[model samples]
Target: MYKHILLASDGSENAVRAAKEAVKIASCTQDSVIDVIYVVDFDKSKSDVLHSGSSEAIDIERRKKNSKVIQFLNDANVNYKTTILHGKPGPEIVKYANDKKVDLVIIGSRGLNALQEMVLGSVSHKVMKRVNCPALIVK
Candidate 1:
């Protein structure tokens, strides 16, 4: 019965699965909106320009990741919006969800190895700890 759902995607297979699940949730909740966010780690990019080809690259990647979800939402007549943020994925997602007051946060598991996750800390794990609302993590 969530009125607003946030879907965080990084264009991975697990992310696509999470998008599909968010779409399904949106379709079932009347007057609900699905907010999709893709975070770009601009700080990590070696490119010096802020508004250069990197912007284009981000747009292309967003479109590629969002097309299927958008199509499904359109077919289901669900309302949705997308946003691109520049920051670390976990913190960005948590901030967006809180700022937008989303009722739920749905994200994909990065499928990192246990040792890698222990060392690097997966985004989903961070979101789960930081988000105020409920979070659904899809693997």
Candidate 2:
């Protein structure tokens, strides 16, 4: 029954599954729009390690991933829009939902246990706590 659905993706397989689910839900509802967001978190150490040879390569790869996600939406013929943001994944996702006044959010859960979640905070947990909108978490 969601009018505007916000789906967060990290280009992971789990996220991709969530995207497919969101699209299916949207297809059943009339006048519904799906918003897909990809967050690019800036980790200097990770960036340095990954981009040892060239930073341009990293940028190109990021763009390619973003393009692939957008292409998937187009190929599916789903009414959707894509947003690429730079920030911590959880907060950025929550903020975008609130700012856009989305009816619901569909997120992928990494299936982290309490201990693992405590050590490395899960994005789904953080967004659940912070987001005012309803969330449908997919595994």
TM-score of each: 0.82, 0.81
Candidates' C-alpha lDDT: 0.83, 0.83
- How do the residues 1-139 of candidate 2 rate in per-residue lDDT, one tens digit apiece? 8889998988777777788888889999988999988888876438645765676776667657666556667777888977878789999999999998899999989998989999999998788788888888998
Model 1 deviation from native, Cα RMSD in Å: 2.8
Q: What is the lDDT for 23 in model 1?
A: 79
lDDT of 1 by residue, 42-70 (tens): 67455535544776775775577657656
Off by over 4 Å in 2: 44-60, 66-71
What total of clashing residue pairs does each candidate reach?
A: 0, 0
In Å, residue 78's CA in model 2 sits off its true spot by 0.7
Best by TM-score: 1
